[model samples]
Target chain A: MKTLLNKDQLNITLQRLAHQLVENHLSFKDTAIIGIQPRGIYLSDRIAHMVRNITGQKRIDYGRLDITFYRDDVQSRDIQVPSDTDIAFSIENKSVILIDDVLHTGRTIRSAMDALIDYGRPKNVELLVLVDRRFSRELPIQPDYVGHTVDTILTQKVKVYWKEKDGKDEVVLIDKV
Target chain B: MPLSVKHLLGIKELTVQDIEQIFQTADEFKQVLQRPIKKVPTLRDTTVANIFFENSTRTRLSFELAEKRLGADVVNFSASGSSVSKGETLIDTVNNILAMKVDMVVMRHSASGAPWFLANHIDASIVNAGDGINEHPTQALLDSFSIRERLGSLKGKRIAIIGDIMHSRVALSNIYCLAKLGAEVTVSGPPTLIPKHIESLGVRVEYNVKKALEWCDVANVLRIQLERQHKPLFSTLREYALFYGINKQMLDGLKKKIIIMHPGPINRGVEINSDVADSGQSIILNQVENGVAIRMAVIYLLSGKKDAQLSI
Candidate 1:
């Protein structure tokens, strides 16, 4: 296992991502920040809080989106427990930023895009990732904001950890045993 | 924990954890139902068949809508106008449908254990909508879901299932579900309507409606099911109404607020009065609304997709 990001490095990267969000989406009037469920939710929470603090916005629209039902491999799995999709507000005409922890094959983002349309058509949509695994794209998808880019073989896995959840802040690359 | 069984044939075959997991999944689907677009794409690659060997309106339509909302292609097969009228066997009928590439079967038959039998023979997933007086797993699930939604939990809650107990799949399934979830269950009706050896199921049998109502936090009143009655079990409808029917006057005389519930196609004045059925304490309509979500959850879970990590 290789430690790709330590605590301080992860904090700086998140701060940079937060700043980029505020700079790109000024005032965030028609913007909606959606965190992909499970892992992406933690990253989205961190970024949404930081963006709100930096922009001094009282109530920025934030929601959690689960794409379990919209996945391409529904027939191939053993068990599927769907997560909560708590998007109370309309995403119609809003600039949507989809946040995920790591972007690998890009299939999850594709499913998220398909799931988002059922709620409403967004004015625009962008992807943000904490880590982007390069040269492993299965779909025509790329991240607009990336914290780190790592190159690896097909057998490797990138594991992300958070202080609130995993009792630490780090990203690790584990080789297939 | 997730539902380990491939088919939802009966509540008797389910554990408390399985019931709770279905409710948890149904909770998420209920949120999806509240959205502007009340559909998910989880079962897009799948196909479900609604094979009703008996006549139905609510159960058939609920299963169809649930399948559609989950983006599954559905085929409705009724025995009335189909080859089953020509003496086709249940296995032959389902096998033919399976040959058409159906992935799941939601069946309601006049005979008990039809879905269970089909599950044993067929490769496709099976969900028993209602099999004679055997079980209606989804109805029990949605009923539990509604109870949990209103009362917060099923543990230690006193629930009385009133009216026809012998011919009601709802009562049997509810009894199994409530008992498994640790709810105090009581069945009240005429002695003939209450099944023999029902006390063996760990439920108290009450002959008087007032006594049952006085002891319960919720009363699930079932329709008399005149179609299923082979002989007149009571003197008349009026006599049954006088003895067991639920009315506003009877409820008001109790001097306490108790939840009222009825499985639909209500007999108006036979089992539950219109005044009480339409009253504030009645959750009949909410049960119907939760039916779609509950069925969607069942279908989605049994469709064999990988489980997503649940935050809650």
Candidate 2:
């Protein structure tokens, strides 16, 4: 296993990503940050928290989205316990930042997009990922703001850990068993 | 988490973990219902058949709506005008339905153990809507869910199943479900309506309605099954209501506010007065609302089971 980002590096990368978001969305008036549920929530929470702190905006449009029900292979795949979704603010005519930890197959983004439009049609949507696993695009998806990009094969995996859940903030790459 | 059990036939067979799983899933489903577009496509490729041998309005509609919300193609069958009136057998009827690629069956039958009988002979999953005064699992589930919504938990809670326990599948199912979840239960009514030796089921029996209402944290008044009365169990509805029916006065007399619930098709003044049924304390409508989610949880959790077996 390789340590892609240690604790200090992860914090630095998060600040960079947060700055990138603040740079694009000044005042965040027409921008919304949505974190995909389960693991994406950690990345979204960190990025959203940092963006709010950097911009000093208390009422920033932030939400959590669960795409378990919107998956294309819901039946054929292993059953996953669904997480809660709480998108209170209006996404209508707003640019939504769809955040996730890792961008691999891009199916999660597809399902997240399908689930997001149900709330309301956003003006546009942007992708953000902490680790961009290049050459692993099952769908035509790319990240607008990437913290790090790694060349990985199908059998390898990228794991992101956060202090809130894993008791430490670190990114690691694991080889196949 | 996936449910340990495949089909929700009755609460009697369900473990506390299963009930907890269903309730936890239904919590998310409730959120789903509050959305602008209240539907999901999890079961888009699945088909479910709701076969009701007995008459129903709410349960049938609730199951249909739940199936639709889950994106399952629902085919409803009622025995009133169907070929069952033309001397067809139960297995024959179900087999015919199954032959057409039906994946799941939700049935309400007049005979006890009908779902069990059908489950033994069928390839598809079976959900017992209600089986002849034996158990109505989903109703009990929704009832407990409503109680949990109001009080936070069913553990150590005092729940009273008031009125006709003899003929109520809701009563029996509620007793089992509540007991399994660590709640104290009491069945209160006249001797005839309250069956003998029901204490064997681990619930207290109270002959007086006032005492039952006074001692309990929640009162789940059950409808006196007038249609199921083979012989006159009580002299008349008036006498039964006078002594046993839940009214506004009884609720007003309680020292503390207790959650009022009823699995509906409520007898206006027979088992519960209109004032109490429509009162703010009553979660009768919430029970109706939660039915869809609970049924959806059951259907979604079970839909994947048969396919898992079929693949092997």
Q: DockQ for each candidate?
A: 0.63, 0.63
Best by DockQ: 2
> Which stretches in model 2 have alpha-carbon errors above 4 Å?
B305-312
What is every candidate's alpha-carbon RMSD to the true fold? 3.0, 1.8
lDDT of each: 0.90, 0.91
Residue range A1-177, candidate 2, lDDT tens digits: 999999999999999999999999989999999999989999999899999899999989999999888888866755666788989888999999999999999999999998999888999999999999999999998899999999999989999999999998999999988
The DockQ value obtained for model 1 is: 0.63
Which CAPRI category fits model 1? medium
* Per-chain TM-score (chain B), model 1: 0.96
Residue A87, candidate 2: alpha-carbon lDDT: 91
**lDDT (Cα, tens digit) per residue for candidate 1, span B81-128:** 899879999999999999999999999999998787787787787899
For model 1, what is the error of residue B155's alpha carbon versus the real structure, in angstroms, after optimal superposition? 1.2
What's the chain B TM-score of candidate 2? 0.97
